[model samples]
Target: MFFATTALALLIERFIGYPDILVRTIGHPVQWIGAFIAWLDARLNPESEPGNRLAGMLALLALLVVTGGLALAVALALRKLPYGWVAEAIIATPFLAQKSLAGHVRAVADGLDRSLAEGRSAVSRIVGRDPEQLDRSGVARAALESLGENASDGIVAPAFWLALLGLPGIALYKAINTADSMIGHRSPRYLAFGWAAARLDDLVNLPCARLTGLLFALAAYFSSRTSAKAAFAAMRRDAHRHVSPNAGWPESALAGALGVKLGGPRAYGGRHVDLATMGDGKSELDANDIRDGLSLYGDALSLLAVIAVLLALAF
Candidate 1:
């Protein structure tokens, strides 16, 4: 039943996406989660208290109780009604990023085709680094790298939790992810404060990140000039070298599959981070490579959908 629910969620998010009208009216679930994170930060993590790691942990505990508790209550209430499982799928659609991720990546390509400045602006929305420092190849690489990492984080990870523990599971995952995004920085402000959110996000995303890498590798098997073997080799050689434990897997897989190199020095608000390079391919990338990456990601998504169906059948 959970697998079937995930399949329906994939179909819905892949096609309809969340309607703009709905977003304008009630706002998105993530926005609501972000709001809660902000409120907690303002109250508990004040500027005067930079080393409040225990406070941060307690705040995260409060967040878990709120999000997980509310989601469980909703799931229990929905379970008693007819056709409620379909409602669960419909509700889960907003959590997945099938259409939005593709759209953002495509926008970067389109922007590059138009002008370099336009390309930088489009990529800036999706990437955290300084887009102004990017050249043509840099812009394209940034887009593709974001596509790789987010493919697992935004799509596969949530779906994995949804299929495993239903509504509460996904809600809890999203809440933790939101906290990590908000405060899990090495900056003095959050270095000690957001330790739990950052660490837990890494732990939860570990399995799904590797799963997404394998899916991308399998998808590459069907793509011309792309090798699953190369993807696997890249993952093994480069994943651990990355600064992040989870993001490296999918990024290396996609970079290897597409025969392109990603990850180098990137600047965030004038802070330079020298990241380990992933994939042993061409250092330069173009808009065409971004399109190829998109195609490969599409095939991987299809494979995930097929697996969901298989799970529904087998169970």
Candidate 2:
């Protein structure tokens, strides 16, 4: 079920690109789902009367039960909809994009190689770093950073959730993640409201993120062009060093696999976010780094394919 769910997710994403119609409908409704859940949570407690740890735990349970139930219902409906699972599967295949990850990364590099201004603009969409003052190296670094972080957020995490819980699970995961991205900040407005969304997203991605790193190491090992042993070692050594408990795993694994360093100080919203580096090595990055990221994405997908095959055999 887990493996099929993963493949189905890949297939759906590849084909549909989350149709604008679906996005316009589901996306907004999903936001309201969060809003509804938040409202429920608030109703459970009065501001003048704070809840205790036990009350908090109960609230969490209630939230999960409600959210998970709704998600499960949606998954069942998607399965039964006129949209055949076969069609969904076909659409999902292209969405997986092991081949395209590198292409996207390369475009940024190629764009940068042509002009730093062009590179910065292209890379800015994917990365949170300031692009206005970027040079060649900065553009490359920002692109690499986006590649690493997004490999998890945009790929592995979605794959993992979908695999485990089907369409509803994936939908819910995306909702939580999107909410976190939008509102789960330490700002004055969302600190308390976004707490549940942020924490839940982190919890959901915890295992998938680590698994992605391991898959990355295995892929490098199998590639023969790279040292799998080194990749694995580097991942083990540096996976936990990044500020994001989950992102460091795959990013560090890729960095070690490709023999390049990623992560460092960057400007976000005009403020410099001085982050620790992941993987040990010089920070020099180029088209080659993007090449490695592309390779890793392929390897991870191949690994998923193998898992699918093994499951078929076992079943």
Candidate 3:
């Protein structure tokens, strides 16, 4: 049932995506979670307090309890309805973002075709790096990297949790991820308070990140860009070089698969981060590279769908 639910949700999201009307009407689950996190942070994480770490933990715990309990109740209620698995799938559909991820990445490519300024603007919507600092190659790299990393975060992770624990599991994971995004950073303001959110997000993403990389490797094998062996080898060698414990997996895999080098020094906000580069391929990127990356993303998603179907059959 879990597998079927996951498969259906993925398919629906792939074809139609979340409708704008629905989003405008009820807002997103993540937005609601973010609002709650913001409220908690405002009340509990005062910078003047030295004990914000504990307060942050308490806030996170409260959030988990509220989100999990509400999700479980919704799941139970859905189970009482006719064709409840379909209902569960509908509820879960918005959580997966394969179509949207691919769309945004493709839009970056389209924007690059127009001009560098447009490219930077398009890529900025998906990445946090300072767009003004990025050149043509940098903009393309940013888009590809965002596509690879978000493939895991926005698509595979939710599917993984949903398969394991159904709707409530995915809900809990989304809540944790949202909190991490909202407050997980090295800044003095968030370093202690956001530690739990960041660590938990990393823990939950560990398996999914690797799995997403493997899927990309398979996609590379199927495509003409690069071989699966090269993708896997690059991932093993370069994945550790990334600042993120998990992000490096898919990013490196895609870099190797596309015969491009990624993850060199880049600026965030105003600070320069001298990070190790991934892949031994070309450093220069263009609009074509973005297209290739999107293709790889699509192929990897297809691979994941197959796995989901197999899991459904097996269990």
TM-score, per-candidate, Cα-based: 0.98, 0.77, 0.97
The regions of model 1 sitting more than 4 angstroms off are none
The number of the candidate with the highest TM-score is 1
Please give the RMSD of candidate 2 to the true structure.
4.8
* Local accuracy by lDDT, each model: 0.92, 0.67, 0.91
Q: Which stretches of candidate 2 lie over 4 Å from their true place?
A: 11-71, 78-104
Q: Highest lDDT: which candidate? A: 1
Question: How well is each residue in 12-104 modelled by candidate 3, as lDDT tens digits?
Answer: 899999999978899988889999999988888876773367877998998999999999999999989888878998898878898889889
Per-residue lDDT tens digits of candidate 1, residues 1-315?
488888888888998899999999999999999998888888888887664789899889989999999989988888888988889889888989999999999999999999999999999999989999899999999999999999998999999999999888889999998899999998899988899999999999999999999999999988786888889999999988889999999999999899889999889998888999999999988889899999999999999999998997887
User: Using alpha carbons, what is the TM-score of model 3?
Assistant: 0.97
lDDT of 2: 0.67
What order do you get sorting by TM-score, best first?
Answer: 1, 3, 2
Worst 10 residues of 2 by lDDT: 90-99
